[model samples]
Target: MPYARLLPPILLVFSNVFMTFAWYGHLKYRDTALPKVILASWGIAFFEYLLMVPANRLGSTVYSAPQLKGMQEVITLLVFAGFSAWYLGQPLKWNHWAGFALIVAAAWLIFLE
Candidate 1:
C-alpha cells in the first residue's frame, strides 16, 4: 500500500524533531542545572527512540539501510533548520545552507539505482 511508503518518512520526521530537541533544546535553558537538562533530554530521547524504532522497521520494507540513513539525515537537517530559526531564534548562515545543499545532494545520490 501507499501507506507503507508514506508512513515511515512521516514517522521519521517526527522522531527527528524529538531527537533534535533532545540533543539541542537544552541550550536555550542554560540556567537549568546540568543534571536536570541531562535527565530531561534523556526523557525526550526515550520518545524519539519510540518513534525511530517503528519508523525504521517499517522503512526497511521500502528502503535500503543507506537510503533510510540518508533520508534521516536530510530530515534532520530540515527539522533542525526550522527548530534553530524558530525555537532557538538562531538563523543559519550562507555556509550552513551551502553545507545542507551538499548533504541533500548526497542524499539524492543514495536513492539512485
Candidate 2:
C-alpha cells in the first residue's frame, strides 16, 4: 500500500488531539475569562485546521468524501470519549457505549458497497 494512504489518518489523529483541546480543554479554565479562553481556543484550533486540511487532502486520494467524513466522525468519538473521561473527569455510561456502538454500525454500513 502507498504510504500516503496511511498519512491522513495519522495526521487526523494528531489534528483531533489539538481539536479536542481547543474545544474542550477550556473547561479547566472556565474561570479565567471568556474572551481569553476563546482566544486561546482559537489559537489551538489554528493548529487543528493546519493538520485537518492536509489530512482531508491526503485522505481524499484513497477515500471518498463520505468515507473520509465517516472516518473522521469515528475518530472524533473515540478521541472525545477518552478526553472526556480522562481530562474532563466525565466517565462514560453504558448508554454512551451503546450510542457509540450504533455509530460504529453506521460506519460499517457506510463502508459497504
Candidate 3:
C-alpha cells in the first residue's frame, strides 16, 4: 500500500491530541484565570489547526469528505479517551464505551461502499 494514504490518519492523530488538550486540558486548571486559560487554549488550538488543515487536505486525496470527517471523529474520541483518563483522571464508563461503539459503527457505514 502507498504510504501517502497513511499520512492523513497519522497527522490526524497528532492533531486530535493537540485538540483534546486545547479543548479539555483546562479542566484540570479550573482555578486559573479564565482569560489566561482561554489564551492558553487558543495557543494550543493553533497547533491543532496546523496539523488538522493539512490532514484533511491530504486525506481528501484518498477519502471523501464524509469519510475524512468520520475518521477524524473516531480519532478524536480515541485521543480524548486517553487524555481524559490519563491527563484529566477521568475514566471511561460503560456508557462511554457504548457511545463510542455507536460512533465506530457509524464510521464503518461511512467507509462502506
Candidate 4:
C-alpha cells in the first residue's frame, strides 16, 4: 500500500523506540556515577529529540495536534511495553494488554472525525 500518510506512523515508531531506550536504558546504567548516567542519557535523548521533532512535524501534516499527541502516547506505551518485555525480561500480562488496548481505543477516538 502506498501509504503516504503512514510516514508519520513510521517516524513515530522509530522515535518512540529511540526515546524509550533513551529514557529507560539509563535505569540499567544506574550503577554508574550519576553524572555519567545523566550525560549518557542526555546524549541518547538528543537523538530521541531529533527523531521526535520530525515525527511530530510530519504527523501534523496528516493529523490534528490532539491526534498526533494521541499517536505519540500510544507509540510510547507500545515501545515501553516491548522494551520492558525484551530488555527487562518481563512478561506481558493480561492487564498490560488491556491497558494497551484502551490506549489504542483512545487513539482511534482522538483521530476520529
- Which has the greatest lDDT? 1
Give per-residue CA lDDT, model 1, range 9-103, as digits (tens). Answer: 99999999999999999999999999999999999999999999999999999999999999999999999999999999999999999999999
Predicted candidate 4 versus true structure: per-residue lDDT over 28-83, tens digit per residue: 66578988877887888888888788877877777788988998888888888889
TM-score of each: 0.97, 0.95, 0.97, 0.88
Regions of candidate 2 where Cα sits further than 4 Å from its true position: none
Residue-level lDDT for 103 in candidate 2: 93
User: By summed lDDT, which 10 consecutive residues of candidate 1 come out lowest?
Assistant: 1-10
Model 1 Cα shift for residue 99 (angstroms)? 0.2
Off by over 4 Å in 1: none
Show model 4 residue runs off by greater than 4 Å. 1-4
Candidate 3 global CA lDDT score: 0.94
Per-residue lDDT, model 3, residue 24, is 96
TM-score-better candidate, 2 vs 3: 3
State each model's C-alpha RMSD to the native.
0.7, 1.1, 1.1, 2.1
lDDT of 2 by residue, 17-70 (tens): 999999999998778999999999999999999999999998988888888888
Clashing pairs in 3: none
